[model samples]
Every structure is written in structure tokens, then in C-alpha cells.
Target: MKKTVLPTMLSFYAPDLREQIEALPEGTALIGISASGQAIAVDLDAEAPHVLVCTSSGGGSTTVLRSLTAQFLHQGAHALVLDPKRISHLWAKGLPTATHRGNVAGIHDALVGLGEELARRLDLADSELDAAPRLIVSVDSALAALRQLTRYWETFRSKDDPHTSPAVAALEAALWTGRAARVHVILDGTPAPGVLGAAPHELFGTVILARVTASTWQRLAPFTGPAPKPSRHSSRGHVIQQGESHETQAIWMTDADVVTWLTDPDDPQS
Candidate 1:
């Protein structure tokens, strides 16, 4: 039997999701990966879904803070979310996707293979996999088994390059198609709406910051519109008026963010 990396479902909610999801083939279900207080959801099979990204602000309310449309992974659809907080709604909809490698020879092998696979896909260096495993299998009863198997991954290596770390390889694969796939990233905390950190530019583009304060929008004013013309605030001094009005100060993104989406990986404008 071929060794596979199965998706280990974590402590996810939504009884409806469970009902609709379980009916899906293991490869055709929505899987969630939660780490470092962050939750990211993906559609492993969403070749037809839009890549809608939702971000949240601290209101303790799981209502739609803001919504945006961007070019997504799948080729033919639009994505919209009522709220960034209610990400569980995606599951309830039975959105089919996951980062799972697939069924292995039972729990033990499944867990270990997944860790090794994750290390290979996330561009993690061999040294990084020492004691800390960034990727995890969220399935029940299998967590312990997976923990036991990942230990052996310390010895696993890619075929072409013996020294190529598992994480590094995984990162490379993740940049494109691979054993597992992610759909929409669920932002629980406030940060850049679509930031992938100091990661390669290929990692992310067209991030929509959900909400911004008037002052915050002002900071980006220079980038937002026409240049500030010389003003006679005082002699020998020039000032630029950013145009007044409470609503003008409000934050909003341009259609460019939507037009220049990541799906068009070939697009230079992206």
C-alpha cells in the first residue's frame, strides 16, 4: 500500500459541517489547520471556488466585519463572507478542501508521515524539525499515534536532494499544487489581512485589510491619491489637504486588489 498523509480533524465545531462533511470522500472535505492562535481553512478540492479571504477585529462578535472579493484559487466563481468571525460557516457549507496527505497504513503511519510531509512542504529546514513540529494532524484518537510517527521523519529526505529538508520541500510544493490544499485562511487576530510574513512574494498577494481607522487611512493617503499640491498654510511652507469629510477619512481598498489577484500567478501586475 502507498503511504499517505491523512487529514487529522481537530476540535472543530458546527454539527452541520460534520454531517455534510463526513459524507465526502476523505480527499473531498474541508480541513482546518490551527496553530499559534491562528486558524487557516482551505478547500483541498476547491478548484472551482473563489479564494475569499476574511479578517477580523476585536469585537468578540463573529459577525461580518468586512467583506472583499479577490481572484481566488479556483477559476470560476466569487467568494463572499458575512463575517470573518463565523468561519465555521464555511464548514457548515461543506466546502470541500484540506491539507491532508491522505490515508496511510492506519493511525501510526498516518501521523508520522504527515509531520514529515508538512516539513517537506512548508520550506522548513531540517534543523527546524528537531523538536518542534509545525504541522499537525487534528484527527481524534490519532493525535498520539501521529506524535509517535513523526519521530521517524527526522530521517526522511527527498529523492533528488538528500539534504533537502522536509519543510523546505513542503514549502515548495505548497506554493503550487500538492498532496493537500488549503482554501480560505481564517484570521482570528488582527494583523495584515493577507500577510504571509517575510515569506516569498509568491506566498501571497492582494491582501485586504478588513478595517482601518481614519488616522490609519491618512497614513496611506500618499499612496491613495493625487499628490498634495503646494498650499499657502504659511509663507515658505507648503501643505497638502487630504480632502475633508468624515466618510473620506474612512478606509477602503481599490478594485486593483480585486483585479490583481493571486490566482493569476503569471500576472506581472500581481
Candidate 2:
């Protein structure tokens, strides 16, 4: 008798992935292709609002960040990249509308500046924000940065200062009030409860889980309903938004591909 064989689910990558990127609707960024051959994307303005990517080490979170950042930047938004490890998203270095911070001190300063900017925007009317450029803060590793920031504050905080780190407070503020200000954050990390002053799902509108276990999802994103089973295919994950789960294979982006977005003269066809 022949042994029973189970068919493995195959991941799809478009041959014209760049074209798919070019064709993304305004305010939407192409994330990847779904298992059923649909383009998976996130709307920065409305649907997603803000994104939190939860994945284990080497789970391709940086790739997702780069793809999203490239599209947002192409659409005229500025980006602030907080990469304490200093290795991810090297293509962003020296880009005109983008700034990269590698050290914990610099990351803290950037977050503080972002908080201040968010406050300024909150004072403006809706018409003013309509003409204002959007801002994306891409944190490569939220957990690591939070740990470093806590230690940094502990070492240098004055007695008069509050016990909690101001940087963390600023981040929490942004999470709470940034959408109306056109300031959005795309964070990739394994964050625990209380780290962000709320549950992960509460802080971010869109949560992308990559190569994470079912328990991780249940704990961090119970609001998304039951988690998808683990897949043998690489680059597979679920994008949970508005209570629906969309299984997807994340877009594969090379550094060269991302650089074009920075230098391509704002023309998608160019």
C-alpha cells in the first residue's frame, strides 16, 4: 500500500511584484500575496491606522517594515527609523525624507521629538493635516529598545523626575493619539503585556503575526479571535485587522529594491 501524502500549502509571490506595488491604491501599501492569490495590503490612513508586527527572531519582520516604509515614503511621507541594532534597513541611511537612529540615546531623542511633533499636530485643524505629510516611525525591535531605554533612564534620571521613563511615556502617548495627527508607528518586536502600557492589540490597529505560535497570538492578540495554525512554508503569516484574519506570504524585498523608492523621483513608473 502507498503511504498517505498530505499536500503542503504553497506560498505565492507575484512575478510582477514591483508592478503590484506600483498599483497599490492611495493610502494603501502592498504587504504580500495571500495564499488564494490576492494582494494583501494595509491602509495607513484608515484601516490599519497603526501597525504592530509580532514575530520571533529571524522571522522577516524587517522585510515587512522595509516594504511598508518604501511605499509610504514613495507616497510623500517622511520616515524615522529606530534601529538600535544598526544592522536592519541600511538602505534608509542618507535618504532625504528619512532619518535613521542606531543607538538607544538617539532612539530616545527621536521618540521624544516625535511626541512633541504629535502634540503640535494635535493643535492643527483637519484641513491643515490634510495638506501635511504623514510620518512613519519604524522601530526594528521594540522590546530591546524599551529595555535599553529603561536602563538609560535609570542611570541618568534626576530625583525630581518621575519613576517611569519619559521616552516610554512619549511612545505611549503617540500610540494613544497619533492617528489624528497623521503620525503612525510600524513596530516589529515581541512585546509583552505592560511593556506598552496596554495590551498589544489595544495599542495597534493592525497586528501581523509571522512565524509565531498559537499561544503567542492568544496571549497578545486575543481580540483577533483564534490564531492560525503554524505553517511549514516560510514567510507565511496572518494579518489581523478589524477582527478578520488574512493568511499571507510576505513580500520579499531586497535592499536595492527599497533604495529605488527613495531615489525614483516620486514616479511609480520611473
Candidate 3:
């Protein structure tokens, strides 16, 4: 009997995030690098519209997300970032494409507004669909935000509030019906059962796991086979979608990169 060893990070000739973004065609989702150094790009319009990134703190999740956000903005998409900690998304604060940014309270309002916008788009006929801009709602530390929202709800539950929890309702609405209206969500955090409703799998089309414990992986994706154990020293991660899994590297992005991306070439001060 031989002991089974899971795959770890291996050397590959993958290009960095900037190169991949430059090479990909407009409107394609840059899904990072495969173990064999292949660039994974998906057409969101034709495929799944939402992504959930699961990882512990300092697990390179933010790097992956910022890379995706930059690519989205470069390709003419509007972004709304929810950063309860107010640190993860500071780089996007003044960007022209960043329509919204702040703590959980702001997130709640933004989602509600987005829901209304989604409704407006849904009401439009097919000929008017081209006027809609692709919307990306990026939530950093989603689990933390959900926990905070829960705490707030508990504090106010005794008052007999008439309206539904705005945060949860907006999130649920986006998860349920925003796909067809060109609205997509990107959540980066640990996956906790019952936090994002009974069945989170139905809400997200793709899941990315990075430097997480085996137990956590199993809990989130029990149907999949053994999760790949990437080397802690490397920037590798894994993506699961449609019953398939692939080893990948969450591309790294820096504050300088973000600043460069957001700065307008024509305006020296931008």
C-alpha cells in the first residue's frame, strides 16, 4: 500500500496578472493560471456570472481579487467594493469606475440601489440591453460583514423593525436575480455554513480556494475530490466549477499597480 500525497505547488511558466490581462480579449474573465501555466479566461456573458473566493486571512485572496477588479475596470466595467475593515479596498476609492465604497452600512445601501438598477435593466426590452454597463460588486471579508450584519440585526430585533434586513435582502436579491442583468458579485472570505443562506452553491457559479485547511475545503465542497494542497511558499490556489477542478495561482497586485491603473494618462494629476 502506498501513501497518497496531494499535489503541491510546482514550478510553471505562467505569466503575471498584467500580461494575462493585456492578452485577454475584451469582456473575458481572467481566471488566473492553471498548474500547467495556461491562462484561464471565461466569457462571463455566456457562463456563470458570480464568483466566490474562499481563504483564510493573508491567504492571497485580496491579491486575486484586486487583480480581477483591475481587469474589470480596464475593460469598462463599473465596480462597487464593500470593505468593512476599510483597508482592503482603499486603493479603489477615487477610481472613476468605483461607483461605491465603504463599510457594511454603505454596502447595504449600494446593494439595495443595485437591486433597483437591476430591476430597471430587467424591464428594458432586448434592443435596449446594450446600454447597460457590466456591474461588479466586490465584497472583501464577506464572512466578517455577514457576522457584523447579524449582530446589528440581533441588537434591533427587540424593537420590532417593520422592514426586512436591508443587507441580507439586497444580497439575497442579487444572488437570486442579478445574473441576467449583467450584475456580478465577487466575495472573498471564509465559507461559513448558513451565513449566506441555506445553499450558497446556488448563488456562486465558481469557487476559488487558497491556502485553506482540508476541513474547510471539505465543508464548502464535499462533492469534489481531495482538494489540492498548494505550497504555502507559493502563490498557488485551486478553482472548482461545474464539477471540475484546476490548480491555479492567484496573481499578485500591488498598490502601485492599482494607482497606475486608476490614473488617467491624459491628466497628469489623475
Say which candidate scores most in lDDT.
2
Q: Which 10-residue window in model 3 sums to the lowest lDDT?
A: 6-15
lDDT, candidate 2, at 170: 81
lDDT of 3 by residue, 108-204 (tens): 6677687788788888886676666788888888877877776666666666664456676677667667766777888887655554564556766
Local distance difference test values of all predictions, in order: 0.27, 0.78, 0.69
The TM-score measured for candidate 1 stands at: 0.24
Best by TM-score: 2
Q: Sorted on TM-score, highest at the top, how do the candidates line up?
A: 2, 3, 1
C-alpha TM-scores of all predictions:
0.24, 0.88, 0.83
Q: Candidate 2, which ten residues in sequence have the lowest lDDT sum?
A: 3-12
Model 1 per-residue lDDT at 22:
34
Q: Indicate the residue-level lDDT of 114 in model 3.
A: 76
